[model samples]
Target: MIAASDADKWKKALLEWDVTSLEEHPSSDGVCVCGQTGLLWMYTITNDANGAELFPIGSSCVNHFGRTDLNRRVDVFHKLALVQATANAGKPVEMTTEFFSRAALKFLFEEGAFTPDSYNYGDGVNDYEFLLKMFGKRDKSTITSRQGYKIRKLVTSKIIPFVLADPRVR
Candidate 1:
């Protein structure tokens, strides 16, 4: 427990705590230690004059803490995943889909998007909704070019231009 007098310091440190790791999946079969199952894995730096500690967190906890950057990164990851899927479909791989996705992912990876980099879970909520609208399926891999060619219009007109303007979320 933090000392009463140290409350401010703890809050400040928490606001600045670096993301040490992230995983798409949980280590346990399903439940987070926090007891929620099937959530994103996030690890934080726990430290001070006393030394250091590490904690595993879920999206709910991160949201509770108001960590906007963490949330934003997750958003960016979902966007990147979509960009990659579009690339696989040859949407704009020859244009900017491949380049932007690669660069965006590299930026996140360098910032510790995943420690030991695991995907035990999967893409976040925003990604699911977006893909569902475009492909009628959650897994982009299952989409067929013949069936999805018209979806390319949406990608070319919206997503590609969106990423080109601000790849990591404006």
Candidate 2:
């Protein structure tokens, strides 16, 4: 993280920015504009008025800028990162039930992950219905092996890529 020489200027700039995208780094090498280093999660914030952008900002710095909305967004990305890490390590991500809340799944759906083009479970269950069913299962033990496999596949193939795609800055 590079130290901001003009703290007031940077803070004012941050107030005009809103989080536009989020990304996860495999290693803790991310640097925030605020001079904080070792960030594993990076956020892209864009200033709407001037169309300027700052990326790879630490979540704490974003919160310190009073953007709690980014904090909530971070939680969703953090959960996805866990599944992404597990999948990248060749582990089954399906057995985990604690990572995704209904809202997170809904967010992904809204982002076009579970749409007809992206996912077709082929079991006659629509994406929204599938998500509802998955969320309804209260425990990992209740999630069948098939369900688990589907969950892992969905996270790896659909949700993660779509959510982490680079946002088109205006």
TM-score of each: 0.36, 0.65
lDDT per prediction? 0.46, 0.64
RMSD of each: 13.1, 5.5
Summarize candidate 1's per-residue lDDT along 1-170 as a digit string, tens digits: 23312345756655644334343442434444466666544444344444454445555655654777666554445455456455546656322333334334445335433233122144333332433444334466666775365345434544455444442322
Q: Worst ten-residue run, lDDT, model 2?
A: 1-10
Task: Give residue 44's lDDT in candidate 1 (0 to 100).
Answer: 43
How well is each residue in 1-170 modelled by candidate 2, as lDDT tens digits?
A: 11222234765655566677667766889888778999888878766666667887888877776666666766666666665565556765552445676656766676667746435744323765676687777674887788767776766676656644524211
Which portions of model 1 show Cα errors greater than 4 Å?
1-10, 26-30, 40-55, 77-170
- Identify the runs in model 2 with alpha carbons over 4 angstroms from their true place: 1-16, 25-27, 95-98, 117-125, 144-157, 160-170
